[model samples]
Target chain A: MKRRTALKVAASAALTSVLTIGSAYGAEPIRFGAVAPKTGALAAGAAITHWPNIQLWVHQVNERGGLRMKDGSRRKVEIIEYDDRTNPGETIKAVERLATQDKVDFIVAPYSTGLNVAAAPVFAKLGYPQVAATAITDKIPELTQRYPSIFFALGSTTALASSVADVLAKMKAEGKIGNRIAMVNVADAFGIELAEASRPIFVKAGFEIVFNRSYPLGTQDLSPIVKGAKASNPDAFVAWSYPPDTFALTEQSKIEGLNVKAYYTAVATAFPAYGGKFGKSVEGHLGAGGVNTDTAEMKAYFAAHQKVTGKPADYWASAVTYASLQVLEQSIEAVGTDRKAVIEHISKSTFQTVMGPWKFVNQSIDKVWTVGQWQGGVFHGVASTGLPGAKPVIVKTGW
Target chain B: MTARETRTLILVVVAFALLACLPLLRHGYLLSLGVDIAMYTVLATSWALFSGPTHYISLATAAFYGIGAYVVAAGIGTLPYPALVALAGLAGAVAAALVGLATLRLSGVYFVIFTLGLAELVRQIVTWVQNNFTGSRGMYVLTSITERMIYWELLALAAAVFFIGWRVARSRLGFALRIIGNDETVAAHLGINSAACKLALFVISGAFAGMVGAIMAPRLSYIEPSIAFTSELSFQVVIMALLGGVHRLWGPLVGVIPFTILWEVIAARFPTQTVLLLGIAFLLIVYLIPNGVVGRIESALRAAQRRVSHA
Candidate 1:
């Protein structure tokens, strides 16, 4: 009697699951593919900005029973992942694998500026919409024209660099700061692009770049650099830096008491640790990447990100990455797995995301935060091309 | 020519014919893998041509490779593709000759250190130039060349490298280099111009590496100092040559195929731990096959012949 009851229970349980799933959505899962630098120089950055966002997007989509189809059927999303080892060759290979070997329905952009640029042609040839979020280069106008299917969410190097100059120029005009400024950059693609783009803009804004030097990316002791910048006695200091160097420079600035009204660093300035470590000191500190975290929706996003990834979403490109996914998901939902149609839809439609309603004009983001400031404990939006919800710039009282 | 040389010539021709048709499958992944193997084969074979006979263990493969790529990137629109490739090869040869003349006096660890530093030194100089002049970090290579085109060019380059290596192995320079590799002082006493022979072979090796780099620049789509002259590439080429056996012209081929497939599998299976797994795999290869698979297999065959004669 006991054996018969157990068998009957298993049959009914299996029958119910099959009936429900078959009735609601009988289509195969849409296989989404992604590549990131899970191991290498950008591994830490990828962990914070790339992989976790992908996971969260996948979870959110599945929570809604995958994407709703055109035929009143729903297909679940199944993700195929690859770690590019932070090598461009590997990135190309992994993307090719996703397109040819695995036959995934879509491919997400690789992380970092160099890598996204490296893998752009592969994505283009394979007919995948390359929505790059973390990549920031000044050559977007040329790149987008060259690769029709590629898109850039992060603003250009010229836009960000000029924005910094404009902000500092406003300070000088207001008599809040002098025309003299000190600048340092880590000698890599990101740092070099920003630093070089800023030079002309700084000159145009009538600012003298008193101390401009570049140290290698992983330089341990920033004392000499700090000493040189301090000797220049500028009213502002800026560092076009990556994460490790950002933290090192900030710590070194604090140690050396390099007092300046406008202190800014790039990349990792949006990281929660920047605030956690510097706390009250980071107030009025300006950096790249900003978010208006006052809204209920933005708060919910932060909560969900923390809950899912066990870390706060970075104030910089993390939202831009997620917003790109939202755009991708919506496009795929409207027009099945047709790559061309999906690209067309994304190119045409306005997407309402955590960052707000926006559309790509000429295959580029219409608006993006050029710079963000640390106000109180949040990374508040201080400037953008759109200028929506931008907070007033605050003066820094030495770290 | 000896029967062995004729056999190797025919076998290399057959291998080239087989590899050139892989892109016909119309599969991106397979074609990319073919590109990987052919690129590595050329790099390792050419590297062994100089380093194997001299036992110099030069790690400047990346330096030449980067020079080749940068040459193409800088001169793409100004010159034709073939011209750029030739110019890249010439540039590499000239650079190699200069470096070899200056640093050939050092040997063993000092030579290794110099060659290893060469890549970084080149990278730094390139960075400084770009920073000061172009106001950009990297340049984009927007060309009509497809992946299939790259694969074919690389395969053709591989064949050319193998043919040159085969000829050099039978040449008088090869004999002198063998003596120099065994004992440089002894070779000098025997009236061998050891320095010139080494420099000649080094130039040839560098030229091949440069051409390969030019062919591969489009695959990366962009060229930067760090990407063009990555240190990992130099070490990877060394590992491939060592694994195949530097003593023979065909040894690096013996190493490149297995390592390429094993790497693809490891990358897929353990994506997050690729570096760690790669370390473990290298350790195993070194421990089990120190003299390389080809050398070990050749020795084993000779031992079997000896046993048969005794019986």
Candidate 2:
């Protein structure tokens, strides 16, 4: 009877010690879910700009001992990711899974405007603060009204269009280019919105629309569009293109000798691969969303990003994406893993990130980095309209 | 009914009963997955309803599907969901009848090319309408319905398609279709009214696909021309049907479930190589089991029975 009592006492002590140690060592991980285009047409861009940044952010946060919770305990981030396949349907399904099935604490936004817009309702319904990193749209007022938890980190479409128009207007005034302008857009939400916004802005700036065309998304051959624009012999060319078509249009333009003093393409024109592919030919080419690479913070961020991810961040949305993650992290650290608290914190606070200080004004970024140009193999901010960094726009040289 | 028929009916009833209880699972991701699988099942089975028995290789699934999606998008606020689904079915049947009237006379590669061209034509027209008339880049449908409800709707649509397919497979229409598939010239010589039968089946098939698209549109919430008219939709349905063995009624169901799960798994695990892996797997399946998993399993079971009977 004594031996039996001692055995029971020893087992109880062992179990107690085990329970205490386990409780002390094992705090539940804060789960962050993301749905990005890991495959399909947008996969290449996502790899460079979206996924790598997320990976880097998660790594850095964990390395720094995770998020400092409001209750004074630290929890490591546990990332749950899904590939949206760059399809809106897939994106919606992924978001639904993240919110309902995985029950992630937070969800990073998908990459593009169309996807972000499509997913806004789902996020709003689930009460997630969707800080969209690459969504550029003109319908901010409507979207904000519908989805109060959604925020656009990228600049608005109107701001982008007006900035480009302003640069062209300045060029026209200086006699660097003629008033005739050629514009072509991909027939999708992102391209269509930009084109619609820019048309009136360009006309108001005294530029005659010499050639205007819209091609379907995922179009393989852009030779006809480039040839048509060249036949018109416009003094400026603007292509509101996605990544694949951006590269295709530039290639076809060079082959067709479609020379214009002011050449601009959207999306992937700021990609490092773009400069690498075009070499010196891409110098003086203009794109959307440029970074002031000379800033010490920007330089360090780029260096660390390359070192960590083993891939170069693009000149445009990569920094924006990383900054959005920073905002989420800051919000989470400030208020713990409670999503409602995170959303409230993000709405009220300003965060200093890779893109400098970011504060939301009515769910849209107050400052916009509108137009960028490739000069001497580097993308420079040629027109930062509502933002600080600005460089003089240079006339694009012939390929 | 024979014992085999009774057993089959009971099994189907029980299967549907279990599927109806899917909402009880209460996993949002699984519900969404069930909805997707149900959508693909409807599409694949409907495609096979005509194309399987006729061997016409219709590539116009996207056209009908896109039309149905657009109809729902256009009538979102004005019409109820059930009403929109019926209208979408009517629209699909009418469109299919028209397309069949024009292209049914053509056979072999010409029919395939015409159907392929039809999808592109419909897509361009929708794009034009969206750009010129609506001036709306995208259409959003506000729905108070839950995902569970959508899953049930899709499940019902899939069950309907399965029932229709099963009935047609046993009826005179299915016999006529098989004969026509085997040899159109011989079927016509036998006074089968091959053209009329083919066109009717085509219309029926399209109606089911359209209903599925209509049901799915509200779930998507936002519809753009590009999303609605993707050729990938047609290709995916065709692949699913072919992968499951188009000749059998349950082949599409078998194909859709596994492929959908595989897709979710591969897409999550290996996002970059999804297409490549899926392509390789498809090629292997085609090489090993040309008639699909159902066909292979059926063949294996028959051989086993024969061996047992001999023993």
Candidate 3:
């Protein structure tokens, strides 16, 4: 019996050794896993947000002799990314595979709000601390309240909406804007949440929301929505949209010759592609953003980002992604290894990152968030600038 | 037992033991790769039941999978795991039967297009359903996951599918289905009940596919239209069956393991080049091994014997 057991064990061990040869090929870098859309509709946004700062951070850290460990040793940061293809199911599968199979030290969740929401419980159950870079929703706070191991770098949805309202109020007080507005959003959770949150804010700010509509994502034609919003004769058009929808709405608005005095959008509006694509038409447009050259820290980050990424930082999503990496770095440094200790480290402490300072209120829930906007090709930080190092950049559109 | 029988028994026992011990043996990426193998094997075997025997290709296998997933997710109210899985399979069969009835009259590439069109239509439906049933966001079930449970579930499902494939290969239904595949008009003239065989195969294929999806829905703890129903995944099923020598019992299992492992290795190390390399490999395989990896090897060995006999 003993001999049989011993032989079986030996055979298993041999197979295991042969299988893990790939793991032994490289020096154990800080094994980090990222869930990004490598292909599909959102591939460009995914690349811009997930890859750039990661490469930048990896370069900077390698320059400083890589990640510092508790044992006074250093290892280079290595990222293994799976393209979720902007699919939530794929994202969850990738995260699980990363957690149970690759056993990476840290994992970066997807940039899509939907993808992140779908993946939250999986990460939480595995006791892996997932830092969400792009998923910002009102539901996150409640989700965080339940899970405690998940963290969001940005301000919560309510806080972000209130801050946008504050900015709009301030702009109005300064006589730069009026009370008439039209709100158009994608018929998706992220867009719907933003529109819902903003509705109350707009009401509180005493602005009449003349036209409000929720259109589907990936909808080819937006002429109807533009025409309707145009006919509403609003002072500003507030759009909660992704790149495709943003471009579609912008094109349709231009085609229809809709003369809305001001145009503002959510997500990816700060991308130079937007400005580059639309040019003079996009000059007076406003969009949400986080990373800008307003502060020394931000300026330094922008320079580093530009040098490494070979492009200007687009939006706050990229900064949030970088900040997530920073958290992963700190946690790994504190715990020495990734899996069990990393979560514990992240659960109980605060870390400084690209978004200034992020401190989780409860380790299980997503509590921290903020809102940003683009002003003259810059993502001006308008909300959640109360962190230790955050510098607010307030701006007015149609200048 | 005869030597051949004993050899088969030994191989079976060894495979079972390896599957049982997979979790204990490998962790992280390797373990996931193993799970992927099991998943693909199940998918291929199920797909082969329809395409191999009856010659009716389903481009909407993934749509049935999505339907199964969404139903289970939506119906998780008070059902047990087995019950839920059964329900999913039933739903899939019903869906396949309904679609098959409508399109079975169309033959050749038109049938293919109809199935493809149906799959796309289902995709749109799921996307629309996602808004109401699973929220505007992606659907997630907040629950605990055990890798061991998933691994074993997949193993059990694969074994069940292997048995079904074995029985089908030997049964009368299998011969009728095979005749239909070779020449439907001839089989129909000879009173083979062509439509019945095709519809039966279609439903059987859908059932197996649905069971796999039901297992997968809870394992990943999430589901979406695109993830549950991608053309790539559907193609992978056919690829595995083709590479392994379709219509054979062990073919899909054999094909999926090596290809899946190779894919993982390439994807992990050289992600940008993985797809390109796969394309090249596929081209090479088609040119060199027209009958697939297994068929080509057997043919080569047979050719060598023929040469020796001539000598």
Interface Cα root-mean-square deviation for all models: 1.7, 2.8, 4.3
Give the candidates in order of TM-score, highest first: 1, 2, 3
Q: Against the true structure, whose DockQ is highest? A: 1
Docking class of 3: incorrect
Candidate 2 on B1-311: residue-level lDDT in tens?
79999999899889989998987987667777888898898899999899888989888898898889888888987988889999999999999999999989899899989988887888777766655455454466656667788788888887888888888888999899899999998998999999999999999988887787788776666676667777878888887888898888888888888889988887766656777888887787778878888898899999999999999
Off by over 4 Å in 1: A1-26, B1-8
Q: What lDDT score goes with residue A53 in model 2? A: 92
Q: By TM-score, who's the top model here?
A: 1
Point out the higher-scoring one by TM-score: 1 or 3. 1
How much lDDT does each candidate structure score? 0.89, 0.85, 0.72
The regions of model 3 sitting more than 4 angstroms off are A1-37, A67-129, A137-149, A155-183, A187-216, A232-236, A283-293, A331-342, A364-370, A384-399, B1-14, B77-81, B132-134, B304-311
Which is the winner by lDDT between candidate 1 and candidate 2? 1
Count of backbone clashes for each model? 0, 0, 23
Which lDDT tens digits does candidate 3 get at residues A215-312?
Answer: 77678988999999989988778888877888888888888877655577877776767777876666556566545446677678878888888987
Worst 10 residues of 1 chain B by lDDT: B129-138
